[model samples]
Target: MSLVLLLFVLSKGFKGSRVRDVRVRGFGTGGVDTWQTTPSVGWSRIVPKFHAAIVKFDIAYPYGKKHEEYTKLSAAGRGSPELLVAEVGVKDYGDMENMDLAERFGVTKEDFPKVKFFVNGKDKPFDFDGEFNAEELKKFIRRHSEVYIGLEGCLETFDRIVDRFMTTENQSDKKGLLRKAEDEWDKLKSPSDQQIAETYVKIMRKVLEKGGEFISLEKTRVEGLMIGRITKEKKEEMQGRLNVLKSFTHDEL
Candidate 1:
């Protein structure tokens, strides 16, 4: 999709999608695009406040359906041994909240987060020893890459089957060889690694079911991902500098 169209889609969210009530000010003044996305009343109105109580959450709108595709792409697998590719498309870097934790705090492994949600707050127990929460991971999709969360999951069966056909154990086609290697990696991991692999497997299955490989799916993939990225520290710093609409107030909205 064209960059202009992508910006249009992202702007719609800034105006307010179901889970978020957002607004933009001072954007396009100095050749820079800036905006804020805040949760709507529903988030805070939920007795305990979903935003605060929950370590992570997302507001699902028609636009947010891109994430469903992310889950699918992440789990994708090629039936043939010739190809085993998993590519993640980051949304827009500027819009992602966890870039701080994902990058600065060292959570992302390559493109994926090592640990997604930290229960009991970052300061409470401060546990950084586990797998990522899928739902929470969605929040960090870079918001800039049309396909920020894309990944490929391969099964040991797939590689073993390919291995059987190769005249020499390591002599399969380059792509096919990589598939076997990935499968080997999967086998030697702890339960956490296995879970992550399986999550990708499930997502890939879903994508295949929906005919996700079709060009039509790219439209959804490319939406709302044209913004530029600012560092997590910079984002917080900017939020403080600019008086964007705040989600909380003493008076009722």
Candidate 2:
């Protein structure tokens, strides 16, 4: 499907509310059932099913930029069965049924857009303390969970190679993985795919030549160029390179 049409379908797919006795579905696989109300009982019953769940605690009728960014994140994460993106809406007045539940999680009305990530094997959810950009949210998910959510300009197959390439102490293993990445790059058909694949191969080559430290040094150099006086096209190019570099360094969020 075209990118625009796919986004439209993902936006529409994220529907349903009220956590009470609801059957929560995977975000990427099919329609996701989110919660409009924050009930402790509901969270206890449903959150355990998924490997990773990102829950947003906000006002009942949320709007404005932050909410829009969250919508983008929901759409971006719509293809991953390993992740669940949801919202828990709390009423500020009237019965205030969800207030206590929100308080239990340390979320307050003052912070209307608090986010928490719950992984299946963890006792407490990790708080999302970063900005609400869709790509940043994806990185946050990847950092905390085993789920693979590719950042823009990153190829998953090459990213897996990068993981092994960074971890293994054996130089021979690293060289073999770099060769494998080049072979994969050659097999890609489209120009855009080849362009992105080339970044992966180039980075692998640089890391092999300069050692593991090249990832950080090159990332710093790209980041510097991004902030300098550069054309829009150049800035975008740097951003793509930065994204690919991030795949090599998991410590970066």
Candidate 3:
């Protein structure tokens, strides 16, 4: 979808001009790579040579006001049929703040409004704990490629049981699909979508008990999530860890 990235996503944000970071980096065999403010290497070697990259590391100043609002949210966070949402300011790596590229990407300085999801040839990179807008970072890169709406009424059985529980590699094929997703969330029947499909099978059974630190626990807000409603001191501050996951906002969006 190039026509200058479909006119930069129908021009919802940009005050363009001057130098480096109007951005572009899409390589499926060297295709659209541009935007570089002195990076002859080092984003852990240019993010595994891109096939996915969501970096939004800021420190502002290049176009002010948090660098033109994260460069118009990385040009409306591109069209993502794979990924590439870059917008790295950090004062273009000068004024003594690169700190050896933030200690070779372990990130501190309070995780400077972080967002790093790179996945090209993988070298361990994933921590976009959602919500810092840009439409939840384009619904977390389209939930790494669509499928997330289940209450019954199969949608390719929860996206083929989350791509066979993130590409199985044994462990009894990941506990036999975590007991076939708790037997399809016990054949739901809308008791609040069977408690939201048992909180999406308890966050994919804690990502199969944390064996592969995540690629898809998949909750890109399928069908606009809901959590009844809160505020009784946020439901008595979540009535004793009501199974710990919470993010509810419904004012008619």
Candidate 4:
């Protein structure tokens, strides 16, 4: 595939990073099980931009096994603004009426359309494609979307890199590869980020030693479908928020 090089501009003399608020929904039959959301409190620190927070509703147990852990994390400021609302579903009209939620969290029914509920609250309209609102919604969705990874694939890839370094005798090359390996290990749970930085560098150096010119990247689909689908304007507005750096690389023939 063809390669696309992206030109990015960095703000001059900018010392403070933009603090980002992340709203993660683990919706299914049950809102993100409390046990699962607990670990994300620590993981959230890895991305300093995102201040840890949760907006949840329960379809299962009122409280999960790790409920106390999440509560503690929130109390310590590690997980801020963790809203645990139970029996959450798509309450279009009800959500809109609840001025308390709309004004406080800004999480209206329009923001989440997949799930619906019959609740005792004001309902909100789902106006995603209103001409003016369309543009704004597009921008919000792109920045707020989540990134997922396959843990097994990541570990196997890291092990392969470590094995390659163990067999190499050149001191300089060995040092470079091992450093790359450690970086990969740190972000193994995040394949896309690790791919652009650590994985690409390691593979390129290895191929150069073997007199090869082309490199390869394996792309995986969730539910057998491609995930990234932000609108053009949304893409331009969201730069560092969603790092699509790998999209610029050349695909192997």
Candidate 5:
């Protein structure tokens, strides 16, 4: 869909909702592209362009909450060359334009806000059954495809180390990955990145000293701190820690 039409639909759909104004101010300015006429363009033209494409099938007039959630996901995916975030706005009224396109994907008006991830070279797209949260959806994409969608507070480099650390049963190999993480930590210049890097390194050391169980124990500890009457800054710090901790435990979808 054209940007103008997408805005028109959102403006018409959201009407009195709290998100309407927020969405109108700045939403699709991020990487979210909208398509009202997918049939003409064809999946053949679209699917081949990226490693994976996350497409939302919803009515031209959609639920406000879903639209808001999708916009957030799109923002997260901005500048990611490996992924395409898009929405197809179907019209089920009047001539029911785009309804035929929706049916081609097994979607109906009742399930308006359906999401699917179409991986390049795949015959079938994967259905997203998780919550509408951007972080959860990013994890979903990461699990299904080789594409890396970095979560907030999670460093891409340390994430790779974590993956290597968890997969190997060899103590020596795990220790080597830990040392490598420390080396990478030393090279980082940003104080904020260093802080996040330190958490990854700390978690790695703790895991080595204790065991894999340290991850769950530490996550619980951080979650406890989050629930306390902490300042906003402290809460955000704790949340960042929590995000890094999640990278250690997120399993394949």
Candidate 6:
């Protein structure tokens, strides 16, 4: 997102126009259900209308001409705007349209190196308003787009788990919850239940040594499930794992 945000900032500061040419780079039905957005848009809408757009612009007057950095921004785009936009839902048009662009975004000539997002092309474009980087853009997009994007494979799975477990404050002294979590984890039979148990087990192994954050986190994981029964073997296995986990090294952690 930083590279993308940088490309946009440069594209606008250097280019003498707005990015309107870069159109829909992909079409898919996957994100809608996951994000709970509007129904799958047709290819026609995805190309230019529904897809995210980055409309950039250069500064005004002779000074704008003297220091415009569009070339540098274009260099970044030369690699492939399509690839960057793939998961980001962004398309760097590289200052395509020259429509009094700065004014349209409510900025003045001083804000030359500006970046605004026309997410889904419905609302008025919004300014990114911070560091021109990927991480920032990702957080911005996660907030604006309401989509959990940018992670892949194991990291992606971890992201989802964290979303479920992330807590800002410490938890109360909920005694004996670890045993309760273990009981629930044992009774779960569905694939998702098993997955949650697996994550709970992984995090639980460090329960005795980790910080309050981990404590709050594990409590959250346990709290997400309802109480349930446990088998004798499962309880024994849990105890055995706890015994081994007591000696976990930093590398093992």
Residue-wise lDDT of candidate 5 within 1-253, one digit each (tens)? 5433434443344344332111112135634433322343344445555678888888775668767877788787765666767776777677676677678889988887888889985758999988887888989999998888788888899999998898899999999999999999999999999999999999989989999999889889999999999999999899899888888885632
User: Please, what are the lDDT tens digits per residue for candidate 2 over residues 60-130?
Assistant: 76789987777777777766666667776677687675677678889999988998899984649999988
Tens digits of per-residue lDDT, candidate 3, 1-253, equal 6423533343323324332332333322223334333233334344444466666655543334543444454555343334555545454344544444544567665677566766664756677775565545544554553412211212335446655666666777767776886788789676755555565466566766774443222223321223546556544433322212221111101
TM-score of 3: 0.28
Report the CA-based lDDT of candidate 1 relative to the real structure: 0.30
For all candidates in order, the CA lDDT equals 0.30, 0.75, 0.47, 0.31, 0.75, 0.38
Off by over 4 Å in 2: 1-41, 121-123
Predicted structure 4, TM vs. truth: 0.26
Error of 4 at 226 (Å): 13
Best by TM-score: 5
Q: What is the C-alpha RMSD of each candidate to the true structure, in Å?
A: 21.7, 5.2, 16.8, 18.1, 7.4, 15.9
TM-score of 2: 0.82
Clash count, predicted structure 2? 2
Sort all candidates by TM-score, best to worst: 5, 2, 6, 3, 4, 1
lDDT of 2 at 149: 81
What is candidate 6's lDDT per residue for 116-164, written digit by digit as tens?
A: 5566655476676755544344445455653444311112333333333
- RMSD from true fold, candidate 1: 21.7
What are the per-residue Cα lDDT tens digits for candidate 1 across 1-253?
3222333443444444444333221112123233444433221222121111112222212124433433332333112111111111222245654243234334343534222222212322122222343322322321211122222222334323322322233333533544554565478657745654443333333333443342234323323222237667655433321211110110100
Off by over 4 Å in 5: 1-41, 61-63
